[model samples]
Target: MNKHLIVVTAALLMAALAACPACLAQTAPKRSAPEERQEQKDARAARITERIELVIARFDNNKERHVAAYNAAKARLKEAITELAEKGYDVTRLTADLQAWDGMFVKFAQDYATLINLLRTAEQYAPYESQGQFAAAIQQARAQLVTVRQDALDIRHYYQTVIRPDLQALKDQNPSSSPASSGT
Candidate 1:
């Protein structure tokens, strides 16, 4: 009986040791250095481009919905600006943000454009390949859209908490310089 117990314990220990590497491997984070860099670049670009587009949309149509959207987008823009600033990028030049943002914007826009085209083409021919592509594109687009919306919220908060107060202070300091001061 003593010998049997010893043998069973040794076998169990061996089994656990053999499984350790696989367990460790499964739990480990898999992001490679290049992948991490690319993800950062992509996120940064997405932030800037989405904000700019939202801003443009606001100005293009001054509806209440657009105004709200603009505010939200501005909040995201400010967050991205803060992030880039922290990342040691001089955001003073719109060119830097523009370049990054433009690339991401074009990528996402083209993806959506392709999805639309696929949808139209699928309707005409009913091919499985086109249908599958369209469905996948739509799923990816929806996920991306959620990220874009969250970024917009961050921009709106930044505008409200930081930009608005500064502007208000400037106005207060220069109250007498405005024609509205006459109460006409």
Candidate 2:
């Protein structure tokens, strides 16, 4: 009877290990596989966000740097909304305001990406190309910067005005929801 119990326990352990590949490792992981994976994802996101923020902070009074900063800001916006999008939440469908904001964000991203590419290509070809061409490219880049700045401002305003109110309302609805454990 004892031998039968031992064999049964060993079989269950093997099955558990097989089911969870991480359990097969020589050393036990501090977190379960899912938790570890989540942590890794969070770390990656943090790194990307930090990189974007660094670009923003280091932006100088130059067209190239400004374009880089705007591009980085676009990346930050994309990353900020990725989890919400991945969760299959239709934020744009929730309200007219949300839909407008979503459209603005998308348009801003597209414009920034195009502008960044144009600026980079111009810079690359500037030395081999004519001065007039380079100057015209700079003028084009500077002209686009105004709209890009406005897009960023609009995004910031939308987040502060619309999203915060909705979030506060949600928090108010849930009495037992603690801010510390919100995992936000």
Candidate 3:
């Protein structure tokens, strides 16, 4: 009888321990700090880059529709910068930097458009030597466009890594100062 009672007591104690919240909590795996943060930053940057690239690709793929779309997207980006400036973000400095970048991108796009137009013209005219020249021009424009695209990507990456983190830290430091948080 004494042995049976001891056995039952041990079983009950084990059962109680299994039911504890602390045991459940301790069973879950811990997350690494840096890994989690890097994942979050990568995801955010990917989203922004994807949106910008999609618009650019849409413009590239559909020549007939692209002019309107490209203009609209550019206008929207400009408006966004203006809005950010109005909200007390450093518009002047950022705009100056972006304008320089924009000029490069515009030149690339113009060259690409000219190349495409040349190709179309060559195809319609079907002159042998002109075809070769048009082909060479198209290839050159494509290479330039690739470089411009890479530059834009680099700028975006910099914005994500340097600009965004600083802005986020500022927002965190002064929660009430942010327009979004202030409800103003």
Candidate 4:
């Protein structure tokens, strides 16, 4: 009689389990292909956002170091110019060149700021919904990065070709007043 009761209970449990699929099918709706595609796009956008954040952090660190180096070099150049002037040396050309390079450096800094702002804007865009706007921001940021890099190279070139040579000429004329090189 106990085995007969167990067999009846097991049959009832099997019958209930067989009915669960039809119950679940009605309770939970199936996702269509478009919904699945949208989910995939949203996931991709989230991953891209994370990567952009990491890039921003690295870029900021490098930018701070670059700016600090620029300021230090500018100070050194000014000190050297003052020392030369005090020693009865004509620093008119060196002063002019320094001013020009300073202007270029200022523009370079502005471009870097613009690039960072564009990346920040890109970060603010919504996943999947603002894809076009996000792409545009990224493209603009890439272009700005190119501009900033070119600006840096131009500043280095101008310093090497114009200012360094002028300073070298001054040092050649007076071997005693050896000013430190601008390590830009």
Q: Give the alpha-carbon lDDT of every model.
A: 0.51, 0.57, 0.55, 0.85
Query: What CA RMSD would you report for each candidate?
Result: 20.4, 26.6, 25.0, 4.6
What C-alpha lDDT, on a 0 to 100 scale, does residue 74 get in candidate 4?
87
The sequence of per-residue lDDT tens digits that candidate 4 reaches over residues 49-107 is: 89998998998898888888888988899988887776767787888888898998899
Give me the runs in candidate 1 sitting further than 4 Å from their true place: 1-64, 67-131, 171-184
lDDT of 1 at 137: 46
**Of models 3 and 4, which has the larger TM-score?**
4
Q: Give the winner by TM-score.
A: 4
**Highest lDDT against the true fold, candidate:** 4
Model 2 alpha-carbon drift over 4 Å, by segment:
1-94, 127-131, 166-184
Candidates ranked by TM-score: 4, 2, 3, 1
The predicted structure with the larger TM-score, 1 or 2, is: 2
Of candidates 3 and 2, the better by lDDT = 2
Q: Write the per-residue lDDT of candidate 3 for residues 61-158, one digit (tens) a residue.
A: 75444445545645665675666645655444445544654564566566656655543443333223344764564466467657656655655565
C-alpha lDDT of candidate 3 relative to the true structure:
0.55
* Candidate 4 runs further than 4 Å off: 1-6, 19-33, 174-184
lDDT of 1 by residue, 95-139 (tens): 334344334444544444444443333333322334475356445
